[model samples]
Target: MRSLLMVSAGVAMLGLTAPAAAQNMPAPMHMMPHDGTLLTVVAEGRTTRTPDLATIRAGVTTQAATAAEALAQNSTRMERVLAALRRAGVAERDIQTASIQLNPQYRYQENEPPVITGYQAVNMVSVRFRDVAKSGSILDVLVREGANNINGPSLSLDDPAAALDEARRDAVARAAARAQLYASAAGLSVDRIVSISETMEGAGPQPPMMVSARAQSESADTAIVPGEQDVTVTLTFRFLLK
Candidate 1:
């Protein structure tokens, strides 16, 4: 009986010691340091290329004493313009009607409130030309077909993904070089890249080149110059200092 009691007392003591030992043990450590030196740098890169595609905005405007007359004249001219585009191999899907409007023409005089001079009708369409080389000739055809109010020949790349990727690579390389230079200047070394973020600028379609009414009326084909467009990217890099 005494040995049984002694064994029970020893088990109770062991249980108490186990809990105390567990409480005194150290906590698990975190993998990342709580306080570390970080360096941030921003860099920009650009790539230039001649645009491959062109978007043209063409329209016809007509004025008549009556609204019906104005609309009829405008429609007749617009149909011819559309037919010319179709003959030039511009796909139906590539042609979109931008706007059609009929507004009353008003003559404002200082002495009089307002005077209704006539009615004006306008029809506009946006055309996308996959073959940029032929865009000038096409514009001439449009003008011949009675497209009086013509604008644009906006230049752009059909696929900007490749250019954007190249810009990104350039941006990252520039960022790394800058970071290294700054780290060395601070008497430190770049251990690793903690984070990186990028922003794209000037990657959308470039401003459209304007075509004058006189230029459209000229006998020669419109002179279309697809200038080089710049694709730019900016990168922000966060690097760990060692």
Candidate 2:
């Protein structure tokens, strides 16, 4: 009889302690409902400024009876162009050979066979000028120094890291402000930020000079105008519902 009474008391104690343990621990997944709505908010910020760097593609094209002759002529003209660029205050490191090609020119006819006229050689170089005021003058010098083809003079930002950092900060601040507004409207307080993701879209490069315009130059100096470039950042935020 005593053993039976002790067993009953032990079972009673376990029953009381079980409820306390369950209260302290999280409930099982089956007892909970997955009906809570998730809210996502996004914010965007932008900054604009005029580009400071100028990128130009200048090259020399040469035609001769033989491929070797054409290449040699192209090389000489390219050397002269590089020398002129250096004299115009463009650094050696800033100038790079973008392309070099040597191909035989063929004449096409209606019923006759194709004939090889001469070998055509091309040497292209890409140049970056930090000084925008001298961009036109540099092109003028390049043209006089044997640059036959001017493919582009696309302008861009030289140091965008600082601007991008500012834009990111602005985006985060905007996201937080929007999140708070939504949380207040829904009769809930934003407890904490769950996650944040950001996307940055860079500005488009400036327009390139037309090939036709490049081939025919009546003026002594080429004119270039660089406008403002826009930098934007978009941020997505997820906040815990309180």
lDDT of each: 0.77, 0.71
Q: Name the lDDT value of residue 177 in candidate 1.
A: 88
The runs of at least 3 residues in candidate 2 whose Cα sits more than 4 Å from the true structure, single-residue gaps closed, are 1-37, 111-113, 203-216
Worst 10 residues of 1 by lDDT: 1-10
| TM-score, prediction 2 | 0.78
Candidate 1 regions with alpha-carbon error over 4 angstroms: 1-33
How close to the true structure is residue 230 of candidate 1, measured as C-alpha lDDT?
95
Q: Residues 1-242, candidate 1, lDDT per residue (tens digit)?
A: 00000011112111223233234322232322233345556778789888888998999999999999999999999999999999999999999999999999999999888989899999999999998888988999899889998889788888888998999999889878876776676566777876677899877778887886668778587767777999989887656556
**CA error at residue 48 for candidate 1, angstroms:** 1.7
Clashes of each: 0, 0
Give lDDT tens digits, candidate 2, residues 1-242: 00000011112111223334335324463432232223356677788878888888889999999999999999998999999999998988899989999999999999999999999999998999898878887787777788888876788888888778878888888767866766566666666665677888775467666543354355576666777788788877655445
Which candidate tops lDDT?
1
